[model samples]
Target chain A: MASARSDRRISADHIPVKLVIAGPFGVGKTTIVGALSEIEPLNTEEVLTQAGTLVDDLTGVNEKTTTTTAIDFGRLTLPGVVLYLFGAPGQTRFQVLWDELVRGALGVLVLADTRRIDDSFAVLDLVENAGIRYAVAVNHFPDSPQYPPEALRQALDLDPRTPLLVCDARDPASARASLIALVEHIRELVLS
Target chain B: MTSGRQRRRVVPDYMAAARLSVPEHISVERTTLVSIAADADAGGLDPPASHLLALLRDEPLSVYECAAHLGLPYCVVRLLVAGLVGNGTLLTRDPPPSDLPDIEILELVLSGLRAL
Candidate 1:
């Protein structure tokens, strides 16, 4: 009976996977991770005092108070599968730290606030520079006018094979759907 | 509102460099940060050093503690501390508190975080 149980556990070992949520400053990378995680999320946050404004970019996140300093982490478990979610550090200067964060992640979910689309480019470039597979989630802001998906694709210069979808970072259902799209994209990569 | 000019006085590079020197065994270069700040602020304090000085005001903490106080990481602190200490605003004693465990210190940090 012990041997049988051990064999069953061994088969279950590889069920869960890791997914990363990455984006630029103030783009809700942590919010998306928290919304989907089954467990209480752990994040390292620091107040974005006036001092940071001089050093880090403050174009879109002008009114921001705090930002992730280290990583924000959460977990989502499925039937015999667990998805570990990690939120990347939000500053461009912190780009050097990504290799360690993305080490074992299966794929990345790149969040973009349509109000400030250019901010997303830094994150997308980092993922591409690292040669990891990623999908983009355009988190809608209330005032952001809708635009054609293809136009956004061209604007961001996204590859044809990369998945791009709309999401409301504040809504769990919408965030979950975006993550599912990322999972499906990764699976498709495997199949190909 | 932001001021275009920062306050600068008569502080020479050698004096700035001598005071900021850290005797710690850590791999950080305390002197290089001063030159960068001198270059950027045109011989005035760079904005990031203000954040680091606030952290150093309390104690000769590790690179990690400075990061926590600023809501940043050792990466940010390492850069800023090297500059401030090199410029004589703060002093760094490196080689760190030895590898030997200090149970009391661990409990104090945990207690501090809990209190926070």
Candidate 2:
């Protein structure tokens, strides 16, 4: 079976592919990771150095030199590769963390909440400025209002090339489709 | 009624405990994959390095996962991993290329996701 082969491949050598699932707080980033991760999602605390402050300070005194944040991640083993999905905090204050998280990542999926659509702008800007390919997945909550695809695209101010879709983070199939959309978007960019 | 509040301990200086300096290229990202070296000799390794080796011996894990399992901060784990890597006791693989991956890899991932 593919699972047996994948297990053996992982023990041996296989490519490690990383993708970021980033959005504002309470945007279901962790939920999507939990739904798609083969094993339970794990959270780890990361320390972000205040490099900007450290560099800008002429005096030796530099308070608040570091900030720690907990990031959740999940792993999925493909045939000969292990795909790691990192659920990252999308607030402006966590921009330093975003710089580190997106390093060497294949792409990013920005999860958005329709009710709080404005919260996703910072993440979208971060990814765009980083010059990395990304797709936006609007995680539909039971109580949130729904909008047409075109309206969401305009509201989010997504580029024409960017892929936008709605997903239910609780359902595996739905979550998987969101990921597939992101990958397909990446493929398009690579082929273009 | 007894006070339910407990005092918080001061954060430890992880940098002070670091014995080896990490390389410029080695990142502390949670997704960076790490594995044990094929010819790793377990003897005489420090507790933290030995523990990291044992964890990887079972199976390769990301630096973040190592921290989670060992109850250490990500910065401390990166230093420990760097120590192991410096001594050729462990191997590290950075996450996929910074730019878009090759078309073939993207295809493989898409197919895999589709199958799921």
Candidate 3:
């Protein structure tokens, strides 16, 4: 029985899937991950130093200087598989890290805030350019203006094939719905 | 907003060289759980690399976790991990997402989320 159980146990090679929650600053990306993750989210942070300034491209974030950005992570373990949910660090300068971050990831979940929809464009572009399959979920804020799905689709220039979902990062059910939608989309992609 | 002034870009070549100085074989992948090899006395490791091996003597930890615990930059930790992997002083496994989780496990995971 012990040997049989070992055959079915989860290991490094058995099933390792990473799903990235990506968006611009203040889009509740970490909140969503916290809602779904089994334990308290762990964060990886690096101080912004003088040398780091050279490598980081601070386009929209010109006003900020002294800040530490963190990559938040949560895990889900199954019998023979484990899923990791990572909140991508929000900073254009961290672009170099994205390649390493997305390595071995199954797909991406792009979260957008209606208040500032344009912030998501960069995240979408990066994920698309990386050739990773992704789904977009709009994190609805109470103060943000609401638009129809088609209107958002036009603004974001989303291909019809991509899935757009509505989510409330604070709510467990809402966040789970968004993840389930993305998972279905991933399944569809695999089938096709 | 340049105000018609041609400002010089401060190029920190030393910093670049230092951070990007990973050995040729060290690829940038999210590191796996790493432990010190039995041959801890292997020579030629830099101070930081040797220190990293010493820290790992207790238990294996992921590169990111180690960086957080040590308060070091991710790039530096990555370089050390790569160097150790190259010299066989550290052992690592491939990252996750290769296996299938049965529906029961998925449900349990979902339940965990629901509890939160």
Best model per lDDT: 2
Order candidates by lDDT, high to low. Answer: 2, 3, 1
- Prediction 1 global C-alpha lDDT: 0.57
Best by TM-score: 2
Residue A113's lDDT in candidate 3: 81
Residue runs of model 1 more than 4 Å from their true location after superposition: A1-16, A45-53, B1-116
Highest DockQ, which number? 2
| Per-candidate alpha-carbon RMSD to the true structure | 15.5, 7.8, 9.3
Expressed as tens digits, the lDDT of each residue in A29-117 for candidate 1 is: 77777787654565433334445546666566766765445466665433333345778854566665677556545678898877788
TM-score between predicted and true chain B, model 2:
0.76
Q: Candidate 1 or 3, higher TM-score?
A: 3
- Residues B16-109, candidate 3, lDDT per residue (tens digit)? 2363345786653554656666665657755566556666765555566555554555666777687768767777655544233234434444
Q: Over the stretch A1-192, how does candidate 3's per-residue lDDT look in tens digits?
A: 796545433343334456788887668877888887664666665444456555544454445453335677776554544567888854565777776677767678899988778878889878877788789999987777889999999999999989999899988789888877776666666656
Poorest 10 consecutive residues by lDDT, candidate 1 chain B: B1-10
Model 2, which residues run further than 4 Å from truth? A1-9, A47-69, B1-18, B21-29
Residue-level error in angstroms, candidate 2, position A80:
1.2
Would candidate 2 be rated incorrect, acceptable, medium or high by CAPRI criteria? acceptable
Give the better candidate number (2 or 3) by TM-score.
Answer: 2
Specify the poorest-scoring 10-residue window by lDDT in model 1 chain A. Answer: A7-16
At residue A128, candidate 2 shows an lDDT of 85
